[model samples]
Target: MLKREVETAYDDPPAAETVNPQGASPYMLLCEHASNYIPTRYSGLGLDAKELQRHIAWDIGVAPIARELSRRLDAPLVLSGYSRLLIDCNRPTGVASSIPEISETTAIPGNQTLSHEERAYREAAFYWPFQREVGRILDQRQAKGTPTIVFGVHSFTPVFKGFVRPWHAGILFRKAERLGHALVDALQEPGLTVAANEPYQIRDESDYTVPVHGEARGLDAVLIEIRQDLIGDRDGQMAWVERLVPALQTVAAGALARA
Candidate 1:
């Protein structure tokens, strides 16, 4: 059974509906899997401690990098507060992976056989509102004739099953070829293997970043995937941000110059 309650240890900063007081910057950062927090409401969907620790539950090392990147760039960030186990912010709300009945090979007692109403509640409560906030930010920027660059940050496990992912970072995108290419080129560091859409590809199936935000608005966008092991600690996360921030600024500045 799923129980909803409050977790004092995990306090949500504010509702997604609330805009950042500093206003939006030309660069907008998004971290879909920021927190592995399960609202006391669902008691973590019966996941074990280890499962919560897995990359499937959250993007390890991504939250800190996203936060640091936002601070360093003075950009407003939109992040999901719940664990992907409850409802994946990256996947479309209607997809099975969005609210997984089974994740990391463990069956979730609460997510199993979720009724239409229950699914809708989660979608409306968590998914839609979060997305609406992004849309609001974009609309405001557009109205002001300020072009914006959308960057989604994510982290993947170094080893999945028996296979090891070798790249330090990867980029995912569909038609924003110029923007994507520039970013990869700028991030070319010694011994750093940068994959251009290697591990994951941006397609129609990609909901949050490519669909509703990028393609929908015809904005220059890219999704960056960092190796989890490289960014699991504070030192590692900062190092990545230091490397990525400059590349991003260069790409954004180049794009704006063309426009």
Candidate 2:
């Protein structure tokens, strides 16, 4: 049994925002969990402000880093405007985690028992729009013969479910192994512990952007996850931008040379 689908007007910000849309760089940055806003129509999805602010609602500090990456790299970036709680742009539509009833240990009351129509509404309003935008960008680039690298920027909590993660950052990929490993090697600073894939892994069922827009199109793509604690402020975010921009440039150049 399922609850009657909540039929609310689709309002709030647009599903996606593009920055430096015409930038010349070969990289296209994505920040899927960029916001925590659940729209007033959903009434905060039955959670208080504190819960909405948690890492479960969104990636804590990846937006600034993504914006900086877009600025420094002169690359186009696409960022989701709504919370992952409404609909995760990074996740495939049919996955349980796509509209998580329980994110981490916190139960999402609004998502507990959604009807198919409710899920479809969210997909239509939030999920599909973002996916379409990304697809359009990639398609345009392909038509122009412009080489593009898709990079998803995200942040993970230093500790999750009472477990501590040691990596300062992680580079995740499935099909773009060479570029992924190259980024891993490049990000290995003296004081930083960079992992090839830790905290989470990329899967077609679990993820959308890389698989659909990047791998499907045969473009190099990888998701970069920085520890949330490290990028919680401007100074921290800038430090990572400084570290990542060059590494990405170096790798992008190498990838082009190899192509």
Candidate 3:
């Protein structure tokens, strides 16, 4: 591949937003699919406004929950500011899904048959910066001898491909299986359904954040996926935040004890 550097200028919002950067908590929250904003330059990726608002553009309600959880837990949170349709922050760069031509059933007209310059521009403009910011924070914490656990917050559609999903929430992990299982067990309740790695699983080709930033550094990490229908509103988001803050705290404590 020829190396081409594109000079990216931001007219919309920033590529990433970090909150509570000074927080002392061991947990670091990441919302990779936080926003559904396509830069005006992209012209909504050749889709209507309605399509951009759909779950394909972003995780439906993960951003608010992540913010509230960060506030409640006093952990630093990092959020990507562009639509996943532009370039999925959680997916590996140069992959098919990184800049998906088709998300779900909707075809992205703007993403079709791009030149190398276009692909590199999107990665340079929107993708790499977000990943670099997360890495910088992790580096700072590691340098300070602070123990850190990476938590990726996401939400899934209640129904996917005409099949109804019964999981209220899911915890996804690969190498950090122990932490993933602990969180899955911690989230169990009398009637609430929590599954271990459902809807989607993390892989090198399909994911970037957990594998590159968390597992590569040998830090405990997990991705939490809530059903979108459950967290589509403020009340639901707050409720999940309340439920998750404690569960995450308990799990972190247990991990520390074992460490």
lDDT (C-alpha, whole model) for all candidates: 0.78, 0.90, 0.90
Q: Candidate 1 local accuracy as lDDT?
A: 0.78
Task: Report clash pairs, candidate 1.
Answer: 3-41, 4-41, 5-40, 5-41
Residue-level error in angstroms, candidate 2, position 228 = 0.3
Q: Would you estimate the TM-scores of all the predictions?
A: 0.90, 0.95, 0.96
Q: Per-residue CA lDDT of candidate 3, range 1-259, in tens?
A: 3243333344677889999987888899999999999867678989999988899999998999999988989999999999999999999888889999999888999999998888887888788889999999999999998989999999999888899999999999998888899999999998899999897898888988789889999898899999999999999999998889899999999988898
Q: Poorest 10 consecutive residues of model 3 by lDDT?
A: 1-10
Give the lowest summed-lDDT range of ten residues in model 1: 1-10
Cand. 2 TM to true fold: 0.95
- Candidate 1 lDDT for residue 221: 82
lDDT tens digits, residue span 1-259, model 2: 2233334445667888999988889999999999998878788888999999889999988999999889999999999999999999999998999999999999999998998788988898788888888888888888999999999999999888999999999999999999999999999879899998787898988988889888889998899999999989899999999999899999999999998
TM-score of decoy 1? 0.90
- Model 2 residue 125 CA deviation (Å) reads 0.2
